[model samples]
Target: MRGIADIFGKEWATPSAVETLMRQNKPKGFMCVSCSWAKPADYHTFEFCENGAKATLWELTSKRCTPEFFAAHSVTELRGWSDYDLEQQGRLTDPMRYDPATDHYVPCSWEEAFQGIGAQLRALDPKSVIFYASGRASLETSYLYALFARLYGNNNIPDSSNMCHETTGVALNKVIGVGVGTVVFDDLAKCDAFFFFGQNTGSNSPRFLHPLQEAAKRGVPIITFNPVREKGLESFINPQNVTEMLTGKATPISTQYHQVKVGGDIAVLIGLCKHVFACDDAAKRDGRRVLDVDFIEAHTKGLDEFEAKVRATSWNEIEAASGLTRAAIEGAGQVYVEADRVIGIYGMGLTQHVHGFENVATFVNLLLLKGNIGRDGTGISPVRGHSNVQGQRTVGIADKPKLVPLDRLAEQFGFEPPREKGMNTVEACHGMIDGKVKAFIGLGGNFVRAIPERAAMEQAWTRMELTVQIATKLNRSHLVNGKAAYLLPCLGRTEQDIQATGPQAVTMEDTFSCIQGSVGLRTPASDNLKSELAIVAGIAKATLPPNPKVIWDDWVGDYGLVRDAIEHTYPDMFHDFNARMFTPGGFYKGNAARERIWNTESGKAEFTTPTMLSSIGFDDAPGRYRLLTMRSNDQFNTTIYGMSDRLRGIEGRRDVLLINPDDIARAGLVDGQMVWLVGDADDGVHREVGPLKVTPFRLPDGCVGSYYPEMNPLIALDHHDIESKTPANKSVPVKIRA
Candidate 1:
């Protein structure tokens, strides 16, 4: 019951805990600030999962980072603390400014912080400033942040998407003419079968298991493909169901689980398509009409080229690359062929790779082959990370502005918005390192720890003229200060958002484009903490020239004004933004692909063939293993709740490496033995992070798993997906060495 004790110890007695439960469990209350998994309309009494509760408790802790707390701790002293230690220091109660002389963060007034930020921003060319967004920002806050960036004459709005779902957006846009998933939340219940690729929905999105369990109970087959078997997907006991919780009976989730090798998603998809093509030829010879010939001829292009590419690929190549037998692939292929409505669900496992764009394209090609697009129970679904990461993109947050209506924004906001694409997350880091970026403002997220090459980026961040973080709690990002760095504390999603007009409720869009209203019912953590809207407006007011062009003050007082601006900006989708958000389950931003209407240059869904499956294994380098970075069951992204990862059978440790027994033997290492991991580099600069105890785990040979941020140092900044600009965190070349 250590798990139960943590819930009660860190949270039970606190006022924040009581308030959090009231706000979270209330019918149609604020959305959980955890994963982006969609929830059903008939909300349960307790809507939160274990991680969601931890996220809330951690955010709403009674412990406060008062001015006195900062006075005692120098930046130098704090730098020695771990991520968990830093977060445990509690909520930032006031605005702070880094004093270089003392090497400490001294308390500063909100006005002083905003004006200083504005002055620094005004001093630089807009092109040199990067306005970054995190998934935590509400729709209103992100929309305002984007507008502020564009009005300031730059579109350098890099967001968390550049790190996670950019590949899904790029790939889906190319083939389906839509950047988001075509399937709705209800489709989970309707789909005949699900083909899960590279996503561990169990730990990442525990709420998602409700649908998976229901579907499994209904005898709907779920095929899972990942490097390691996740317990949540294999069998789950819903904590909400008293009978299941008390009886200790677990529900089986996946009918078939294939341990695909590292970076093997594309090969597996290609192999499945190859088998499908063979079956199609056989059926056509017997006049059985297996392939969706009419749909393919009418609604798609480049099929002949794609078909030839699949047919030419050999089974030996598929087996060697995917680490799956030909019979196994054919069995999955047969399942796909037999299922009338198939939904393909994938996550970062398939996206964070050199061939991420091609990986997603391969899955889309499979869905399109069977006339799955536009069908009720059939389509592509990318399980997005972060609650409103997708919403941030929807409301105009991007380095390269894709799908944003510039003409509409210009007409509504009375300013010529920047048309040139800006720096993405990786590009922004590089820009900072090269001195090209002068100022940086992050709405939320721990940028330093979240990005690769933390050591290099940490040093690069010191050179910036201005660095501002608008956040709720203390994180590692605040420690890496620029010349004029400021930390502006904002109200948490659980707290009340009271403006001049009265209480305000923000909005957010989930993974599938469902917009939900979020209103915080709890009192603010501190009276000094301001809402994100107020903070953005304050900076905009201080920076922008005084004019009636945009009523910044008015928008701050009333969020409905911001919603009005949003509706005025995107009249088609966000029409009646406020009214639509009030609907029982909120509104669904309809996708063009869902209607089978392709808005592509070809006016149809395009079938593109990958050149060739890239090699995953290192035959020449026998001692090296392909490292796949992942989060523990107790963690969410960069936030570490505790040292234990109960789901993986790991306890009281964060540095242990999960390796296959065969790989351990091959590396001349014993289970439970310690070893250092030396990264393989082509640029003559290598990083080593280890002395980590090796734990024997079930995984494909030559593949090992480790928690992210710890393994982030091993990743080179240069190693990334060119099309999506996402870091290739899943397949890092590393070796077990002394």
Candidate 2:
């Protein structure tokens, strides 16, 4: 309740917002602005989580950052403010542009802002502009952003997925027919065993605790593979559970939690698959069948080669690389061997590494070893973080736009979309660094703060000729200006988006590919603010030439027209899109993997074997710790609710480094000691971030953890997964010094 009150102030709170909360809070109501965890079709009295409520309150807060407020604070002054301070100044009430002479943001008319931006955009080469979109925006906004980019003859539409789950999609596409998870939310309740590899659901996706608790109550095994024993995974007391909350008792979450060292997930996964093969050999000797030979032969390819590779991998190498005992790895295999159905869930801990793409494929390989893809209560579930991230990618926002989607766009909209692939997050940063990209526009996100190599990104950003941000509040990105910077304030998800048609509702896709509706019920915080759809349409209308093929005004006014366009673009998937949007719990875009139909080049699920975890020259060093970045429970992405991380047992600070006690003693460091962190990257790029206070934590030996964005500077922009091009944020070789 304090968390809720802190985000949504007390004095100016409205009863109408409460009514809307009671009416449409997701799974039963509309949708939420939190994580993209999938919701069941069944309805509940209250379907929201604590973090979801905090997100809602943060958006609908009564405070306002009016024009007068900006007049009092200059851009230089605001830069000194922390991330919390900048956003907490209040909601931006009007569109503002940075004035160079005064070092301040001043209000400008919407038309003037759009015209100036459009003229500047038209003056530059198409390849020189970069359009970045975040998951927070709706599908309509992302679609328009992509369309506008392609219409302008450029494909440089890099999005938040580039930093989060691009590896998941890329890996899944190669292994399976589709690049999405196979199971829906209901599968969580039906699975006999749940295997979590490098995922801390407690802090990332709290709502998952509901299904986990229920599964645990039914005596199902919940096995976890993480370096640190997170509190959310150990035990959880659901705030919505009256009995548990009143009694102060918590339900168990992880029945068997194994601490795998950072960057060791692929090795661990290989060990598990190898164990299953050994079990199959023993069953054959006993004249019994343990392996799904029928499924393997009929539904998959490359089993012979995959099995040979698994057999060639020695147990000694597996144990050493995985930082696990042979018995523990085999024990996990035994659990999987006994269970008829299993669900494999993984988070960034599995995806944010140099071998992130291979790490994801390893999970798929483990599942396919048991034929778990197309069965009840079983499949691969890659839990995405931001809400609607899946949806944005589903509609159009791909850097490498596939031929099918591009063809669909041309057939539906009567224009030839750009065929060339564009820059991803890493490439965009490099483009800026090289002065190839001149303009940068964000749909909704703090791009500079979210990306890696912050120092370099900041320098690259300043080199740009134009930078525009479409946001709800001030962030570090707005302050880090280019030659010309503009901030276009837009309505939040909790505020009413009254368009020319009427009150508007946007649709979002969850982690499981479930599409749902979201309708804000509160009055607009500022009449000067516009909806994301309107903002996109305004820019497109100003920038693009008049054409009968596309109608920007009609599409923005009535989102129904946008839905119709989407339906026409993806007929097989989004047919009757408008009708499905009104369904009680939204419709599911079924994955072909769930039907045992492979869509790969061979028309069968392929088993991919990855050779390396890190690059070839990754030499191991003693007294060096592998540093990974994570968010505290009090924060969501770049937004700060408070500084305290209650679950992690920290308070009033974000600069604490979590180090293993043994490693601390070995490094000759004491608890609460201040130390500087220097990068040990093999690329010869020097980077440092510190004077961070070191705190002894219960993590694996030679492994450490710190909050992200603060540690972003340590990650070199060029260091990423070679296949997916995602920045390796979870594993950075660093040395600490007093």
Candidate 3:
């Protein structure tokens, strides 16, 4: 029999295999790609993404995280399995706990697990329990998670946002007073120009290709500035449409691509500002308004201080700091200045760093200064991932104190919300290391892989009183067992969601403030598996103060009631949520963002200065490489679907790291040589993880890139954004050793 790697390697040579891969993510019977998961997708679906197809197959595969499977394998033994192997063990059917004495997992009934969980909570001093939520969670499920934690007397809702785009939230709120992208499908198509910073949209958001392709055909220039020259940004093939697929053709992307050095994005933003201000100065001398004159007069503050900073910045400094010449900055700025309307989009490449918030703030500054807010075909978009990630944060998922939300909860629920500032991902890790946090409840995510410091993360998860995961499939998190742990299997996007009343649909908020309805099309693979809402209801029934006519039951039984509650919770926004969702294409109306009526301390979009901390963004040495953490085409986030990164011509291994030929020569290493990564962990700790193979690829000089989870060990749990605590998974210093 062929090995798994060999099987994966062999699949590519077959024409049928190539076609299968091309059609891997075609929009099957579903109306749109977003709803593809709702139906029993043609496994050989009509259309889907490679990663999406892999994720779907992985979820629906014939594997089981059953008691029998866990009974024989020791935690120590299971820890040694490959990520694929662990997940391939199948869906977790019941709750279980670790038995160190036997070195195996022992089955524990649902009732016993919850009773023990309740006991563990009672033992906690309220502040010690960390509630970790993932973006994959449904809005209804998210509400319950927050409610449960809040009722437990602590707002320790350390969520997925803390690790991903939470800094975007912080920066956007400071400027626009809302924390989501302002553009949609139409915005991308109609824009005269689009600016991409610190993000590779092609790999990160495959769905974005549709609009990007349309924009490219219409001659709308898309300028990309990233440290690495991601293949996705340069070109792409759309499998959804047969013309691009059958012809084996791809559309060339990026009118201009600028390869900036890691941590140099802030400098680039500053350069753009200098050019924008220069144009404004030129326009003022000519006695004509290029920027929105009335909006600038009535709205915005700190322009005087900001203008001073822009004028103070020399061309030499901007060029040197950004790794882009003065000419390049002017050339890019010319587009922004000449264009009537433009959209700026970005992702984790900006957010996962020390000054991530600053980078985002700088972009917001550009938009507000140009009076881009409250306008059609112009805005800054922080391209979001997962289904309803933004909605999670909107409905009180933050660990920080939200004055109005707590007050409303108190008035409505007859109890005061927890006053303590809760633990974030970093804080949770710290708490675990210090023994302050005794329990952790992860809603959905490969928490072990997602969190930084692999050794500490693994140790912490293994030490928990309870580590519960509400997941659709077996992941690294499920195997991250504690003394008492639970892996409760749940329904996937393709499964049917049956409530007490009838089948129900879930809702999701896209990158733009568009809220739409989502319903599953396929039947549940197993009868035991529950919907996320049902699981939340079950947990709430098991944990909450047992009120008659439980809110949990009502929300689970009918998602419409959940929408009604959402309307009540966010009256200004979802006033007529039920009636609106019925509209075919759904809704994209978010007033606070669209109208620019900011709900801040002031009532308009504001300007925020960029805060540069170069010391934290890069290595101290001149030649040290700044490596970015990335994923393969067959992967989504940390869920590795296959061994090949087909987009880059890599296969059979996850150990290969991409580097430019120039950087390769400077490192004095061969293409296939294995080397150790040298770096200082944030806590004055020296760390080295090795045997990573070097592969030649298109990346900037003085920069190297590696796939995540494998390189996660090198990330210091303490190396995080100062304000938002998002892990600095990007731009870490490293010296490759022989």
Candidate 4:
């Protein structure tokens, strides 16, 4: 009903929206731009979820932010508008450039926009330019973007992964020698148990609920550990199920849902390991094997040290840190001990903390104890938010010098790629503030809104020499124009992308590493909009000096040539790229860890030991609440779809803070009282955002919740994972005041 209302209310063509939803996630149709969950091998006509429908319909809307609309509104006025209003103005129709004289954006030809951007790039050192790509871009476009950055003389390419899953990559690489999740979609069906930590499945990726529903019906134990009791984690009724829809019966998702304290994931993980070790000690005495002794002995290392550390940690400390009773922790542990093959899944909540790296490493350590990885139905799965985030990183949109095959890339493009390490998202922000970065080029995203320290970044963004955004719609980032800024309109994923060779099919990698092809079916929102591939090629052609080896025009004309370049650069992963992409349900780029071929230093899966009991070193201080930034049911990333969060009962507003009743009373605040959330960062910066209505909920005491990007102002710029540099958006210490 909400999906239907949003579709029709947005004035999208009903038939086209319906048809697009039906084809979304299908083998021959376009992929959903919402989430990274993989499509089932057995296809369904209605594979798309509510959020997926909203994302598709959003792109298919008839509303347009034409040149006339921009001419009427100044950049200063647009800056005062809410993010929802800014995007609701609709699809960008023409290449627009910021006019400082009028403080408004004026229409310009594509050629002029490219040339102006190119001239700015040439004026500044390549090291000073930031090439940022969002997950919305295709692999072909990302490949070109990365290649263009290297050809222009630097490797300063940072994508969406740097914000969400950077810690996952750093942690997994150290433990299993692979950064991506080892499990495929089939693993969900075969796993005896599933352990989800910090992930809200129902809202983040609704299509994933189908598999969870099936698993629950089969009596598989689905354990969840999150601070908030997400409705999706509780119960779900499959809209596609005829009986479920008619009878209004819902399937129970989580068998045991533990509300672990914010930043207490490490504590819970360690406690679980402690129980497993105790169980193993008793089992060995009784001549019964509880642990995977054979598997562990054959393919693991550092277990002795990790086990010692877990045993050394007292249960009382664990209980205090995790905010759970001993019985509850032991009960969850018992389930883990009983299950033969358990799949451990997590989300950004585990990775967006100061100890984010340790959070992931701890989870991997728990899985490694029982040899849970390297087997069917058992491994680690980091459920990503964006559709093509993993794909962007896979195709080499990375800031690290060692992550990309620079030599292979140089050979393929006949250009000496820069080998110096580049900046991640956090570093990029710092670079901009320090006046070290001169230009900012975004492929597709609301960069200004998605990042932390909103006030600081907004001011620093204006100081840049050049800012270019290749996007489908207007966003807050477009308004934070540099001395010179250009907005290049691009085609959406659902719309047709035609080139010289005919229609082109771009590919996206899901959370499971399945490379599924996405072919746009609907006519583009505007005839003036160009494909992301063409836009990227145009910038590359205008910026780089003429080269015989690189043919930007040809690559834009034929996307297969881009795939061929990707194959040449990443031969092992993308071999036979063009043909394999068309395979039904797509092809799985195999994980080395799945095959038990560990790529670690010791050639074995490693058990990592953390020195700390918890990520945040909060001593249960009075008046201090651990605040976690989250997405509402109505939003995807930073893009607000609507004001209502149906799952949490939030409606007609977003400026509400969810808190526990006890905490609200302790702070002398009522449920409907308006309060301010002041950051306790102690960074000499006064950070606060409020007049937020206090909504008492069933979260743990001393833990509160608020929507992300809105609450991002309270997050300090330096508050992030030291190793991965992912902002600690999940765990910020704050005080509530009237």
Candidate 5:
């Protein structure tokens, strides 16, 4: 009903919506922009979820945020509008530049906008310019964006990965030599058990529920550990399942759902390892095999040190840190021990923390004990949120110099690419605040709204000499304009992107490493709007000096040429890029860990010993509570589709906090009472989000839940993982005030 209403409410044509729905996730059709979840090889007629429908309808909306709209509304007035309201204004129909004198955005030609931005770039040091790409961009666009950044002289290419799963890459690269998940969609069918930690699968990727439902029907144990008992984790009635929907029979998801406190993942993981070790010890005495001794001896290292640390840790300490009883931990461990094959899955809940690297490493440690990697049904799976986030990284959108093959890129592009390590999301924010970064260019996202320390970021953002945003709609980031800001509207994933070589199809990699083609079907909202590829090429043409070695126009004209360049840069992975992309269901970019080929320094999977038992050291003060920022069902990252959070029973309101009943009473707070959440970061920043209604939820004591991006303010910019520098958004210290 929500999907239908959203389609009609957006004033999108019914026939267009139907056609889009039919084509979404199809072999030759466009990919859904909602999530990175992989589409099945044998796909159903309707492959998209409700959220996917919302994402499609969102792009297909008939309303337009024309130059006239901006002319009527001043930037100051638009700043007061909600994120939903700003986006609701509709598709950006023209290239607009901020006019400080009039305090409004005035329409400008694409040529003028590109030239002005180019002139600004030429005036500043290329190192000071920041190139930010959102996950929604296609592989072709991202490749061009990265090339443009390097050709202009710096590698300050930071994408959405730095904020979400930077830790996954950092941790997995150190331990297993592969940054991406080893498990493919087929693994779900082969695995005997599934263990989900910290991820709220339902809200993030509803399409994933189908596999879990199938696993449930097979009686496969689906164990879950999270702060919130997400409704999706409990049960889900597949909307497509006619009989089940009619009978109101929902498929059970998690067989055992443990409510681990915020920052308790490491403790629980260690506890599970301890139980496995104890069982192995007893089995050894009975001359029975409990551990995969042969696989461990052949394929793994550092088990001695890792096992010693787990054995040294006491049950009392584990219980205290995990907010779970010893018996419960052992019970979960028993399931892990019994299963022949297990797929350990996690999301941002594990990565967005001060000890995010350690959390991921610890999970890997547990999997290693049973020889989980390199097997058919077993591996580590980090569920990515954005559609092309992983693909962006694969095709060279990285801050770190070593992550990208600079030597190969230099050889392929005929230019000396920058060797200096550029800024990640955190460093970029700090650079802006420190008055070092001068220019900011965003491909497709609300940078100012999605990042942390919003107030500081916005203020620092204004200080930048130039800011360029290539987007589909008006966002808060556009409102927080730089000194010389330009908004270049681009065609969305749902719209046709015709080039000189006819219609083009771009590729995207899913969470499972499957690369599939996505081509738009709907007519573009505006003829003035250019494709992301064209916009990037325009910027490059205007910014860089004339060079025959790099032909920007040719690549933009034929994306296959871009694919050929990508293939040349990464021959092993994208060997037959253009040909393979046209293949039905696309191709799988194989993982090194799956083939037992570890590209690490040790030449084998190594177990890591965590120094800390928990991600955050709780103060245990009277008023202190750990904050877990989450996305409502109606929201995707910073984009709020609707006001209501259907799964959580939140109706027409985002200003509400979910707290345990015990904590509500303990903090002297009553249900439905409006209260202030003051930050306890102790960093001298006055961070507080106000008058939120306290709603009782089934969470562990000393832990509370609230919507993300809204509560992103409470998270200090500096409070992040030392290794990965991913923001510690999952575990923030806060206090409640009436």
Candidate 6:
């Protein structure tokens, strides 16, 4: 085992360092709560996670955003500021609409901001508006966002989910009845074996690594397959845990780690399922007790298609396709077949590739092959990244299937919702390019940096009739102004939530799909800090008037009524949500959590077999390398907390790209060598869509990885996961040049 110094590349760790890793959930979000939609009764044991804590701190804390701060700096001045510098300026002091005459954001009254927002909405054909939801929205606020959008007669519910997990819903609806994950946190307790694929638990979902660690401690085998080697998969000393922190003790994590090539998850997943099926078939042929034939026959269909693909797949193809030896894959399969209570979990590493959705389906098939569903310690867990991202999608946030959302809107408030489909986040940006979408309203999020195609995304926002952001702090998106742009500040996760009704809490979902409650503990950083719900209400009031609209006031003030509205919209799962969520762990909304009842067409778990892309050609063409934009220890998504990457040997900088020794030698470059990453495709894109300046380090040969968002400019926006429209963050074809 490496020393603690080796693990952290520094002294044991620091409190601030630990803090960046711990913040995730807090109830004092800029939105109000509604118990029926699963708002927490209050903070429970483990009420907030580390990442949640950081998010809360970033939201609340002692930071202040006052007019004095803005007066000291202009938009052009803020343009040269670093990400951390921008965030450190603190919470917004007041509602400020951008004034072109002064080229600075002057403080404006809430009344004028609302009046401007309402007039713009009133002028637009309601169908032209797009309401974007960040996962950070509370359940109450999420429901309100959906309701207001639909009431305005537009089904353009493009949300963060479309950018991330829409494929899970799209693929699972055909295979699993419902479009959600199939595991709960408790499910990990009974799991005899765990399979983690294409996930880096260290950065994306650090809290989840605990379960894998516990499974390892219990002597349960954990097979982790990913394209890149992640440090979090190793032993992690939970610095926040008193005993672990004081004792300086750590627990071992992954039992075995396998590095699969980019886009290799599909083959590896299918290979596991095929081996399990083969083991069962061999047992049956030999009159031996091996296969879960009874379960397979009783609960699954399309076995014929599955086995056919498995049987037809050549061993050579399997080995070549997955970048794994036949023995290695079979070993993973052996563990799956041997363990009675097996669980499979994956992340964006699986879903960001070309065949990402298919990869997810195959994992479900592996679970079904062993009849793992609905059983303790057995199911599939997709570790989501953002806190409230899943919640944003759960409440009618989608581009298609307008009827159900529209009908529910009409049923709830007697308004005829728009039946036409809407634009997704990506589509919204693209729509802006084509003059299809006019106004862009961000409920809460940094859209310009969060979305791909930096130039086009910014341009899209610039072209809008009005671009508004309900943000706690200034971000790159806040500057992406339209003709009539405004920056309406909102409360953060760490601030005191207040509405016309009372104090409120925004809700978010965890990696395990369990709904929990969060409330901020810190005092409001600024009096001007407004709740996201209040901002939306103010906007809605301004946009639509006594224009014969649904009484938005009915749902305003007390968020409890928002829960009632959500329950009315989606009754099956949210029934008694207010009461149950108030009881403690809030509420769990996935089928895998609710007694393994998969909401599928056959009402049974389904298996999928994927074709392999074996034998990747590592053609030595000068500086060619597989590049993956990455996150660091001090970064959450695009929010860089600091300039340190403790895991990758990076220090005080994110301007370098990691390259293996052999790759450097082959490319005729040295460590710390300055180089330009020349993109390979000739798509005739913008000037910033190609190569980028980067420093060098030792990484895997033929593999290169760099920090995201900043490095994101290097990746062409057109190069995306075709299925999900997720930026090609994990996989990028590039060349390292002088």
Off by over 4 Å in 1: 1-5, 11-19, 22-27, 615-620
* Cα lDDT for residue 184, candidate 1: 93
- lDDT tens readout by residue for model 1, 652-712: 9988889888877777788888888878856677788987999999999988888898999
lDDT of each: 0.86, 0.84, 0.72, 0.89, 0.90, 0.67
Candidate 1 yields a Cα-based lDDT of: 0.86
List the candidates' TM-scores in order: 0.98, 0.98, 0.91, 0.99, 0.99, 0.89
Could you give me the TM-score of model 1 versus the true structure?
0.98
Residue range 270-292, candidate 6, lDDT tens digits: 77767877787788887964556
Worst ten in a row by lDDT for model 2? 611-620
Indicate the worst ten consecutive residues by lDDT in candidate 1: 614-623
- lDDT (Cα, tens digit) per residue for candidate 4, span 1-738: 675476558655547777888888988799999998887668776888888888887888888999999989999999899999988888889999999999999999999998999888988999999999999888999988988998988888988888899999998998899989998989999999999999988789988888999999999999999999999989999888899999999999999999998998999999999999999999999898778889889999999998889889998999988999889989999999999999999999899989999999999988887888988899999999899999999988999988898888878778788999998899999999999999999999889998989999999999999999999889899999999999999999998989899999999999999999988999888889899889888888888899988989999899999999898888888999999997777798888999999999999998888988778644557788899888988888988888888888888898999998888888888888899999988777988999899998889988999989999989888888988988899999898879
Per-residue lDDT over 1-738 for candidate 3, one digit per residue giving the tens place of the 0 to 100 score: 022234344222222333433433223222222211211122333444544444545554555667788777777777788887776666677666666688777877667666766666676677888888887776667776787788877878887778888888887777777777776556666788889987766566665676788789888888889887778888988776689778979998898899887778888888888888888889999897567768777777667777677778888877777778989888998888888888988888788888888888877777776777678898888877665677787777778876237776676667778886888889889988888888888888888888888887777777777777777666777677777777777787655688888888776565666665656666665666778777666666666676543477778788888778767767776779888763444466574766767876677677766545241454457556787888777667777766877667788898877888887887688888898887654356666778888899887667788888788888888788877889988877777887
Candidate with the larger lDDT of 3 and 5: 5
> What 10-residue stretch in candidate 5 is worst by lDDT?
6-15
What is the TM-score (0 to 1) of candidate 2? 0.98
Ranking of all predicted structures according to lDDT, beginning with the best and ending with the worst: 5, 4, 1, 2, 3, 6
Runs in model 2 deviating more than 4 A are 9-15, 613-617
Error of 3 at 127 (Å): 1.5
Better of 1 and 4 by TM-score: 4
Candidate closest to the true structure, highest lDDT: 5
Candidate 5, 357-408: lDDT as tens digits:
9999999988988999889999999999999999999999998888889999
Against the true structure, candidate 6 has what lDDT?
0.67
